[model samples]
Target: MKKIIITVVVILIFAIIAIYCKFILGLASQMANPKVSTLEKEMSWEKEHKLWGDYDDYEKEDYIVKGLNDYDLHVTLVKNPIPSDKYVIISHGFKSNRYGAVKYVDSYIDLGFNCIIYDMRDHGENAKATVSLGQFESEDLYKLIEDTYNRYGNIKLGLHGESMGAATSLMLLAKKPKVDFVVADCGFDNLYDLIHTSYSVAKVGFVLPSVNTAMKLRYGYDMKKTSPKDALVGNEVPVCFIHGEADTFILPENSQVNKAATEGYSELHLVPNAAHAQSREVLGKAEYRGIIGDFLNNIDFK
Candidate 1:
């Protein structure tokens, strides 16, 4: 029995080591070679759906923002014709671009808010294809907010981000609490939980340490730093978290976690019979718009 116990312990140690090595290799592979699929490429169903829009009338323009590595990051901006002091920065999710959020631009514009929609790194017109989730993308948001303030001059800023973008917005608040308000839709509370969800969706066993290790190696950031839970805690900014009750991608609990993290000031709206980013589609535009309008009316942007 003693020998059997010793063997079991030895096997567990070896398994753990093997998993760590696999994650490290995965991270190295991602960093050594970043790959972005072509905007025209339809690699998967999700990719195809994400690319199914034309922003011809959106009138896209480019802006170069200075980055930490002296990289003049390029951002595509879509401006509303009717401008106002209130402005919103919309961030798209993983494997998606500005077009994905264009549908909601009018909602903000109708409220007399000018919208600035931009593509994240390794996405859209950006010259890379590696997604660090919100690990590095959060910096993009910070830079954009700063640029907006410089150009527009101390305007009331609002944020709308979906999935990975939502996570990025939360991380941005943790790093810098400048935005007046935030709307996070279907954002995962924890990076570690997100990785586990991905694995579960693929019918794989949970390897929490492996996912955490991979994130650390790829982004040079730990899970704690990337956690929306930590970011939302004690945040002064009022956040409205919108999640579909039927969402399986990030799960509604993730939004609840964010709400709990932010005290009672943060609001969570769970749309019934909706599924991930489909709240508007499921509830119809009028109802969806009304919900957001009510939230905005309740908040004091001053």
Candidate 2:
């Protein structure tokens, strides 16, 4: 009987270690090497949808900045010739590059706001290859905002982000940067909750808590600290939350909770029948552009 009990204990210990290594450490590595969409596929989609109409014809500049822990970030500046003091820094989603901002670029340009689109670390042209979810990504945003302020000098600034980028934008709010408005599209509320929901369908929910603990101990990433819902609480910055009603990946309720947590200072726009970041594409250019334009115009930013 004693031998049987000892054998069971050994098996449980081994299982714990296996779960930690496989789900925790392995998951982090997988996130760092997400499958990126090819240029051909991106161009085909753009052509079919007429997204970013004539974006190639615009004048652009290449900008680079150093992020936290010496990580390098690659950025593209889309110039607006209207000579306005308004500017926007747009951050793309997980596993996506600055090219993902194609749908929103033309509208911002038409609205006379010069746009800056950049790649997050571990994705696109950025030299570094690591995913902190949003812990370090927020630091990258700080550097970008600071550089933009230095270059433009006290201009009206807007911060916009999608998915993981949206989380980073919200996380940055904890520091209260000098920006007129924020647009977070399809952002998750809590990193840990998001991970749990993503893996629950795969029957991996039992291992996720252990995985998060392992990530904290081994990788120094406290997943619980990366909550956008918590960040939005009492945040005075004018925020516009855009999400799809059919979004199961991150869920529409997360945005609803975030908007509610903002103490009635934020606006929530749910696009019917849209999924993930497909609000713009699904709503067609006119309606989507109108929503964004109205939000920007109401902000009273020049």
Candidate 3:
């Protein structure tokens, strides 16, 4: 009887270990390398979701920018007819392509800023690579900012980002890019807490630390350090934080925390009845445009 009990306990211990190993590996791979939506699908998604913008109507040119690790980033230059020195670089969300930024183009153009948009790494037409949430992504955005400065020669610049792009923009602030302002929409404050919440919502929160460990081993970035809020500690650049009041995916508190974290001039606007990445849609074009225009004007983001 004693031997049988010992055998049973050993089997149970091995089974638990095996299950834990599998879960950690799967989670590390899944989060670090999610399947993204195709560019064509994202355009159709924007239309189906009633997002308004005509990418073809703009006079734009395409080119490439080398990012961190010499990774090539596909970029677009959409010009305003007036030809001004003010520029805004718009970054789309994770799983979305550069075209997803079209919805905001009209607003920027209306505000008299030329629009620059691009496909983030591992999204759209870019080559496949591990997603480090905001670590490498922030570096990539900084590269784009530098390239813009080199090409334009003394221009006022602003950054506009959605979801992951928002996080990227905020994270890059730690590097102190030379820019006028940042408009972040529906971004997460921390990758660790975000993913932990995801796991908790699925009833597996306890596994996150192990998974994070696996992530560091499999991919070379630490998940716990990917906090956009933490990045703003010493930043002085003006940031406009926008979020949907009803955003449950990332929650509006992400923007709230960001506004609180920034030592610089900041504004937090919550769009009523909007979900994740749906602030502009819910606020309508005029209201959405107004929020950004007012923020820029307030900061004299010329």
* Candidate 3 lDDT score at position 149: 94
**lDDT (C-alpha) at residue 182 in model 2:** 90
Clashes of 1: 2
Stretches of model 3 off by over 4 angstroms after superposition: 1-12
Candidate 1 residue-wise lDDT, 143-227, digit = tens: 8888889988968889999888899999888776578889998899987667667767776535556655665666576665678
In model 2, state the lDDT of residue 82: 74
- What's the number of clashes in each of the models? 2, 0, 0
Lowest lDDT block of 10, candidate 2? 31-40
- Candidate 3, residue 227: Cα displacement in angstroms equals 0.7
> Which pairs of residues collide in model 3?
none
> Model 2 off-target regions past 4 Å?
1-20, 38-44
In order of appearance, the predictions have TM-scores of: 0.80, 0.90, 0.95
What is the lDDT, from 0 to 100, of the residue 122 in candidate 3?
Answer: 90
**Scored by CA lDDT, what does every candidate get?**
0.73, 0.83, 0.90
**Candidate 2 clashing pairs, residues 3+ apart or interchain:** none
Clashes of 3: 0
**Regarding lDDT, does 1 or 2 come out ahead?**
2
Residues 31-89, model 2: lDDT tens digits: 54567665456667777877757689988998787778767888888999778788999
